[model samples]
Target chain A: MPEHESPIVTVDIVLLTLEDEQLKVTLMERTKEPFAGRLALPGGYVHTNTDQNGDDAARRIMTTKLGFAPSHMEQLETISGPTRDPRGWSVSIVYVALISREALASHSAIPLHLYPVAALPELAFDHNKIVRRAVERLRSKGTYSTLPCHLLPARFSIPQMHHVFELVLGVPLNRTSFTRKVSEMGILELAGKEPAAGRGRTAAQYRLKEEVSFFHRPLGDGM
Target chain B: MPEHESPIVTVDIVLLTLEDEQLKVTLMERTKEPFAGRLALPGGYVHTNTDQNGDDAARRIMTTKLGFAPSHMEQLETISGPTRDPRGWSVSIVYVALISREALASHSAIPLHLYPVAALPELAFDHNKIVRRAVERLRSKGTYSTLPCHLLPARFSIPQMHHVFELVLGVPLNRTSFTRKVSEMGILELAGKEPAAGRGRTAAQYRLKEEVSFFHRPLGDGM
Candidate 1:
């Protein structure tokens, strides 16, 4: 058998963010054939020399295709189908990312549609299924994981962070309880002064403790 | 560009079972190149003619590649990388399946190795990552989903079922509580009289209630 007969696999990034409190995924219109001119996730053939590891592959895809860096990019799942590609048999590793709305507010070259997960139109390849799985991961695992932070800025207030959780989980949380629970985690530290906004006393700003490891906790154990 | 120039995606199945109280994943020694003669998970390329809907691709891949009929299979994730396949840029949809030890034991000449996931050697492409993810899924979400049933025979006792849970989760479950929780789920029905064994009263034989939708429940929320 010749060397050209082997199979190939690649990675695709599904960069998601909560813009205006709605779940949105970044998509790019195709510039090549097969699914050319159609809207799809911003990804291409996985380059060998791009990044050192799997997380870097996602970062590279996001940077090259979307022109922005994601705060957190995670391996969500993989999608493979014999006929998914018109060329031949190919498999793809799909990674889902979360970031703040302001991160990509100015990227216009790639032309992205921040569509809600529920109202997303038919996408190229098996990405629709991929997107659904990402949504499920976000909704279910978001409770316990540091995923909530992915939707907020690096330096933000408790109320702003709480709003992100409400948007993603589709559940309302008591403000007092949420504040107490988050503070006890010791994952955040006060940034000094409070934000000047509507309230009896302005809320304090916080920055995530850099050395803390959030992956050790069991999924959905507590939120 | 010609239609043949496009890339394709495929799905692979990691049919897992418990044999002699040990966890095992189904693998085949490849007769072709690209990790030829090495033990790899049973899979095949995806094509338009295999299934009308993308969701059915997993079922088709199992039947075509391994020559077995599985009752169910769920999409785990997708993997894609330029170097993962030497042929071209391809992606694969990986699915993890669970079946009873009795089913695998009763079947013969399936051309598979029941390898333990923990001691697995370097596999073809990114298969090691795929297997690891599948095992993590089983360990975490196995309780909430109908995963245990997938590892049980058509009719089995509560004790037999609990044994499987123990093997997969690596935890001992209280017999009384396990049975009580399972009964409350209303997802398993008494198939008939239990198998007679030396000792106490014969336990009732039970089978999964096919009507209950197990996927919709929250993960880590059930027994």
Candidate 2:
């Protein structure tokens, strides 16, 4: 096969976090051709020489583009088309990384541009579509599973988890029902200490026991 | 970039259907090098000039290898690694297509090899892993949505749908409760005429009302 025979392959990561109760995504300005100086998901070509697989390629891209890679990275989906990139036919193995704003602020080496995923500007290639797909997965999983719990720090209170679910689902949930739903799922464990609230009451704290726990019944039909 | 710089990209499809009351997957023996004469998922190199996208490549591979593509095709996860392929790092965009045995028999131009998903033998590349992933998705979706209805014919009876669910879930469901659960889902519309069962009894007929309907509550926790 000739050089033009294969489709251009790369890895793109959508790093999402919560800041000021708004879901934000990390992006960088491409300094190379095909979208130079334009905002895009932090990504680059797959280094076949050093990358053992897509996971390796994703981690390498994140480490190279950003200073440090987030601990939790998930394989989202692969997007390919003839026109998605200025280069010939291309395939992008996408990943979704979740982190807390506080954690990200401590690790980032470069000046990171964070944008609200709901109000993102025009991005390079089909990145905007990829970001939307990742967000859709998170939102859909928020209904019945503790997937959105990844957006929170390792230790989170039940109320904090409830608020994260509301933020991801983009709707308010009944406090009691939401707490009951989490209790029914049994995916959370009691954390060490309780956090003080405005009323001088200590809120019950919980930590996720699994990466993701799905209960048959949903908290509320978000979609 | 050199020829080897771009990873080889291909499309593989796991065509699954219900046959003899068991979940069977379609595979073909490869006739080319790098695993010639070995059983593998129906797939081939991505035709960049012709294929519009991954969907096109999957459809093309199915049509060329299996004579016809299934009516319902899902974009399963993509698999990639350097050691998985002998030549170089490769990316395979995998798909899972569901069709009834009756429909498949009518469309296949050549002899097809059908194997039970649970008893799969060694296959070329990482096809077994891909098959398991597809089955896992089906099983997970089976617990909460009308996804398994796709494995049946377009219009089927309630008992027929129940049997298909049992096959996918590998569990016998209570007859009355299963019917009630599906009815609550509101995913099935009356398919007009009833099918006569044994002993002068008639079974109610129903057809899927949506591509996929999620009722929040699952039929049962299959996983």
Candidate 3:
């Protein structure tokens, strides 16, 4: 196939985080003609000259547009069709990244806005569908992996971790049951620290085990 | 970007099935250059003229190349980079499909070969990596969904179903435990039929319930 006849390939990232107990995704206002002044996920065309792969392009886009690197990133899905982009057929290798809200606070070079995943406004292109897919991936994987930990600091209390899980899953879990399940996963270790001041009794802090990628076993009920 | 300078986009499918209690995948010998006369997954360039999206391209590829349509198909991953394809920068939207051995037996227009997933020979391009990703997706999803049913006929006995799951999961599940788990999922309905001619007493047959997409809850422990 001739180059122009082929679809244009790009990378759009769904950068997710927890803000005030609500799941939010990063969005930016477009400054180009295709969707000038409209809100869209931060993305750009693949730089074949410099990028080694789509993953590289996604990381570069995150750094240059969002001003920080995500601690956890994975290929979410690829959205493509003839009607996705007005210019022509376009294929976007969408990636999902999880980061702490504090990570974004220190790097605010770009004028990006964080909107709750459920209450997102009209976005450019087919980004709304992309964000929905990312959220589904996160919530489903949250049951089996240490995914919610990406939204927390290095060390956190069991109660704090439980709250994060509840927020992502949208279902309140029994306190005793949640803690026991986390303990059984064997992916977390005691950090030898106490919760920060000002909240009732000080709860012992825990951190993810070093070099652990994900839990070897399922964390919760499979669904 | 000029037409000639852009990367080419294509779709490749990892079609999987079970044969003789072993997991097998379909491969075809490439007739064109790049990797002529070598074993590769049945795939081709995206047909922008007719295909509305990658999903359509994948289905078309299956019909034309494999001479059969898969029962289940989903977007697996998009493999992209300058190094993936030898003919310059190319992006392949990989899809995972599940079919039954009987389906392939009925449609034999194309000369395709079935190879065990574990003992695959040197394949053309980066197809080995694509096949590996498909297997991982299948095995992980097998824990929560009725995925192995795609490898069986419409109606089958419990023992036959168990064998299919064992082949895909590579683990022997206790008959009692597996039956209990399947009953709890409520996705299968008794078909009011007896097993086909066999060596022993006739067993009750079951089929997947109509309009069932996936289980509402997880099915079993993660592998």
Candidate 4:
């Protein structure tokens, strides 16, 4: 190996969204060599001069390739297998972002072709595995952590919140029971009445009750 | 650069032990180049011929450096910055191991030194940050996940379990309330009472409830 050659470090963003009762991820068609024209998560080679740190690299990838700063970004994992990238032996730091589906659909600046996770076509490199791992982490940690709130609007009804959990966990919850459990957790606050937007019962909206700092505090027993 | 000189991808193991309620990590005195004699996580450059995958790489490092495999190993985030290693730009897939204090204190196969998270000396590379991040992840994720159970024996009293949580969370829990809450969750079952070992009450021994898989489901108010 030449002493002057430097290993390239890249960043991949797994932006997740919920739409039509299914989880979707934003992907882009690669425009250059080494897996060109394949659907892949938006990413690019990180330069030391520009991306001074891990957080900077993540932000740069989101802004430069996706054309917007992500509201929430987290470092997921790093892929370092020799064949993960073809042009050369490249390492990529993977980060995940959670965006409200409504905001993404209404906003015109976000550059992406969203695809449902269930029907994802062949993705560039090992992105499929990356996406799957991220989803699993989100699903497992989302239960006891404050992550689910990162996926919805500032104010939402209790039923809406239940849907988010159901979708991520891939299970149905009894409405009365779920509400009672959530209420006792003290993670939601009543934010006034909902102006009936549907034909069913007018429901009360809720906001995040409080920031839970305890990580291992167990949930309540079922009623 | 020659084709044979591929960038090295390695896996580093951060073996953690709880010593006197302080989180501690195992470090090795490097015997080779770049930073010889400097303390660092046990690791080596990985190749497919030596082991099957990245996880295997982690095991190899532990076996070669510690002379045994960890009882509980997990995939932590990876460290792949270009400048992390001094000799060349190498990527490291980091993994973590959590073991009980008594287990570590009784072990003799591993020839290594353990240092508290605080009062650490200099490390070989950018491992200080990696170790710190692993600790942060362990502490935070330990709350919402069943990870802490990995640090305990197969059966333990509720008070002992609560004390483990308090030690990791850095906060004291109300004994009466914590026991009731844990029992109410129905995620624990009596394993027949064991005679008291110390000055505490005759604590009833319990193991995690069976078929409690639903407890792992994601929970949150809303996005």
Top TM-score model: 2
Sort the predicted structures by DockQ, highest score first. Answer: 2, 3, 4, 1
User: Which model, 2 or 4, shows the larger lDDT?
Assistant: 2
Q: Scoring each candidate complex against the real one, what DockQ results?
A: 0.15, 0.40, 0.39, 0.19
Write candidate 3's Cα lDDT for A27-115 as tens digits. Answer: 99999868789889989888877777787788899888988667567787777777888878888888887777876676557666899
Judged by DockQ, which candidate is best? 2
In candidate 1, position A98 carries an lDDT of 77
The i-RMS of candidate 4 is: 10.5
Error of 2 at B34 (Å): 1.8
Of candidates 2 and 1, the better by DockQ: 2
What residue pairs clash in candidate 4, if any at all?
Answer: A143-B218, A143-B219, A149-B223, A152-B223, A215-B143, A216-B143
* Model 4's TM-score against the true structure: 0.75
Task: Estimate the lDDT of model 2.
Answer: 0.81
The order of the candidates by TM-score, greatest first, is 2, 3, 4, 1
lDDT of 3 by residue, B1-223 (tens): 4333567788898888888878899998999888999899988887666777777788788888877667577787787778778887888888887778887777657766899999999899889878877887788878667777788887888888888888898888899989998899898888876745777656788888886643221111130
- Model 2 lDDT tens row, B23-108: 99998888877789988998888988888878878878888888877767777767777788898888888888888888888889
Clashing pairs in 2: none
Better of 2 and 4 by DockQ: 2
Cα lDDT of model 2 by residue, A1-223, tens digit: 4334789998899999998999999999888888898899998788777777777788888988898987778777777878888878988888888887877888899888899998999999888888888888788777886668877877878778888889999999999999888889888888777648577668767777864533211112241
Lowest lDDT 10-residue stretch of candidate 1 chain B:
B214-223
Model 2 alpha-carbon drift over 4 Å, by segment: A1-4, A198-200, A210-223, B1-4, B198-200, B213-223
In order, what lDDT does every prediction score?
0.69, 0.81, 0.79, 0.70
